[model samples]
Target: MKKIALLALLLFLAAIGLFLAVVWNGYEWHQKLTVTMDTPNGPLSASSVQQMRLSDKRGPWNPPEGSGVSFTLSGEAVVMELAPGRYLFALLTGVPSLGRLLHPKMDVIDAAKLLERGEAEAYRSVTLSRRDYPLLVTFGDMNDPASVQRVDPANLEASFGPGYRLQSMTLALTEEPVNTGRVKKVLAWIGPHPELKLSPPTGRTSNIPFSRRVGEGDFIRGKT
Candidate 1:
């Protein structure tokens, strides 16, 4: 009976230790900023964004894995931060939720520089079709082994069917924190490390598209 009680206490202590470790590693300091879109009507706040990509001095450092960091939408802005390095911050917007005025736009900015400047702006104009298909395509034939052709706005009508329209918008980023209380500031020593499994590239292409088709739903649903 005494042995059983002692064993139970050991297990409980071990569990508590594991939980504390997880909390320590997961915590991080996040910077906050507001996003706004300028359109024909007027300036509107960007409550949420579709996707965000980050690249540090080493290379691509995506959320929850590469950098173990992700952005959170708070009211009318986003909260996030990098792990003490210069980085390129890319944000993708133009989902159905934002309305037709906004189209798929990828805005890339130098994070450190933008922070120092206090603001940054990006402009975009793109044509989109009603149907869902690949916007870009690569083609090659056995007869032309050495020749490969790439096409943008691919010829396939399915890729660009009727209901085609053009969209133009401007996005602005300001280094302003709306809700300071929501920001989580963790110590640098306890931050999580990158969990990348693949080895770094050695003069070879590392980006290859999957055979599957990805759409707006995939982005919103967090399926991709």
Candidate 2:
């Protein structure tokens, strides 16, 4: 009877040890990642953007083992590189949620995408006015890619995803801004731009599981 009890106790201890090891590794492996991106405008100054962050470890939302994870693996931030003349928006990845906007094909996701996956059930996004961010927009000729004939924030737009709740932060723009000159050439791409107004909402716990398809930034065409 004593031998049987001792063996059982040993097995229980081993099981607990294994459990702890798994937990520790999970926490370590899921540590957040950070990255930067340059858009047609100046670095979408961090203070001028809205943000949302959340993650879920289990389930239909998570990538298959060895497939690479999303939110839990990286933190995303989107910054525009708009300039006075001749500016190009380079894709910025690893920003917690903004990454999803740059490349949906990538394994990662933004706050809204995670919400779609059911990871962020309480996720709430608000659409604000473009008057907030300091920037100017020129409806460039898609044919030239860099040809700017006029600058019109009215014809000018600073929108976000075509449908995502993602909000844009406010930045100062040049009034009566020029469009045909360098200002026009700079900040060219216009697939709906969003200024990332604030940090995305957060869940109380990481274990909050999720899965689904929630689109962000109808900003590109969402408003139209």
Candidate 3:
């Protein structure tokens, strides 16, 4: 009886250790960002999404298996966890018809093709601020690939019909400001420009997370 009890205790400790390891790894892998979709008229279901693509200007890519950006579709909200970096988000969704949009015949569509075809449902430029830790990006939701429930690829054509459409996209910033020149260049390269402009920083202060450094700007004054 004593030996059985000892084994049970050891198993319990092992489980706890495993759980902690997972949590630590997740924290190190990527930061979580909350994204809320805003439609002019109303919110739509996540099921409308077909796939999502990300680009860092090197090449288009999908969420890597264990440690790349992934999405969670909860009702009208989609949360994405990604390693901190600048990224272009392409939202692919279904539309009733594609009169002018190019219909590519492939499983994974390249982001460039989406641009050339003018079929991208939504496009957004995101820069994850290291200072803000986990950044929050809220905008209109598009078709997300990482929803809790996914549609079978075999049934996508049947589900969306032959006229699935890709349209609408935008870009915005939160927590930190980015270089204006860089933003312009990126937007021009992406082709579909979102109706966004940099706004003056709000003069708000907070100390709960950490105090803002005073006289820090003096060090780099007149350098830029």
RMSD of each: 17.6, 18.7, 21.4
The C-alpha lDDT values of all candidates are: 0.28, 0.30, 0.26
lDDT of 2 by residue, 1-224 (tens): 99999999999999988655443323211111111223434333322222233333444434466233323312112223334332222111212343343334755434334433433332233222443222222223333433322222332233321221222432111112111122223323333334431123355466421111111121111121
lDDT string, candidate 1, 1-224, tens digits: 99999999999999988655554332111132233323334443322222222223222323345443233222211222211221111122222111122322422223323333433232122223433211222223312212222223223223223432122222323333333221112111111222221123245355533212222222122211
lDDT by residue for model 3 (18-73), tens: 66554332111111122222233333222112212222221122223433422211
Q: Is candidate 2 or candidate 3 better by lDDT?
A: 2
* Alpha carbon deviation, residue 12, candidate 2 (Å): 37
Task: Show model 2 residue runs off by greater than 4 Å.
Answer: 1-52, 57-69, 72-83, 88-90, 96-189, 192-224
Clashes of each: 0, 67, 6
**What would the TM-scores of all predictions be?**
0.24, 0.21, 0.17
Please report the candidate that would top lDDT against the real structure: 2
Which predicted model would earn the best TM-score?
Answer: 1
In model 2, state the lDDT of residue 148.
25
Worst 10 residues of 3 by lDDT: 214-223
